[model samples]
Target: MQGHRPSQKQLYDHFAPKMLGVCYRYARTLQEAEDFLQEAFITVFRKLDQYRNEGPLGKWIYRIVINTCINGIRARCRFSDTAGRIDVEHLENESTAHPAAHSEIIELVRQLPTVYMTVFNLHAVEGYPHEDIAKMLDTNVNTVRSQYSRARTLLMKKLGSGPKTNENGKRG
Candidate 1:
């Protein structure tokens, strides 16, 4: 059904759940996620005409949601002094190790600090290159790499994976 057009309601109904999940990954609270969802949908409808069918509608909406979330994070970071200083020790203590599972991984990711979480989600989950991520976040490539590294380290520690090892089983 490439280029098939759907009504606004149809589009919202079809994509809301998945897009809310995307918002939830970036929001610190359920309320914030809902807010992001609402705001993103508003943007989606306003820009509906801009969707040129170059890609799947779902992918297009997903990009809008991600951009909305990133913008939200940037705004929050701008106003909050503690934005980048979330206490890792507290998060680690509150988190539990579970077998590799989708929900478990999402929960682990949610515990990450905002900066690290954004970088991790963009680079690892969304398959964006570090260079692209750097440009998107308006930061240097080295900073993106540092944040991604810290994010992985935090996630591994939270999941009780200790430290990662190289192919030869030596610690990285």
Candidate 2:
């Protein structure tokens, strides 16, 4: 069972950027994302031997990244009450230069409550099913659905419906 081990360097080279993207989505800053990614990588390495290979390695790494992001959020919230709640009013109509961080839509998503953020990211961004999210977050399936509904409502208010076509199916 212990005859062969996955190459650590190969693992890093394969998953680092994608995992970092997961970390960055839930983090407020690049430094925070880097820290989260580092911590997540440690966990991945520790649990590497437990990986059963039933699914893709990227999926396994994604779960680790998500858990790490949640842990980082919890740790920050422990020290400061302001960790989860940030005012986005002042950030409205801001320039949308940066693709991920500075994007108004992404900023709005980041402003959502932690539970909502997690649910939203898993559902909308990561394409996880409500049942899976319920299992992962230890909540009821209905709760996951409700959270996604609420998240979508909030997102619509912030990001607007996508561009509308004309009644005849031509450009508006």
Number of the top candidate by lDDT?
Answer: 1
Q: Per-residue alpha-carbon lDDT of model 1 for 1-172, expressed as tens digits?
A: 2234467678888999999988988899999998899889888988888989998989998999998998889989841112222234433444444334557667778888888888877877788999998888888888887888778777766766557578896877
Give lDDT: candidate 1, residue 164: 58
| Model 2: number of backbone collisions | 0
TM-score of each: 0.76, 0.65
Candidate 2 residue lDDT tens string, 24-115: 78887889999999999888888878999999988888888998887787777531112111223322333334345356667788777666
Q: For model 2, where is the 10-residue window of minimal lDDT?
A: 78-87
**Model 1, which residues run further than 4 Å from truth?**
1-6, 78-101, 164-172
> Mind sharing the TM-score for model 2?
0.65
Q: Residue 54, candidate 1: how far off, in angstroms?
A: 1.2
Worst 10 residues of 1 by lDDT: 79-88
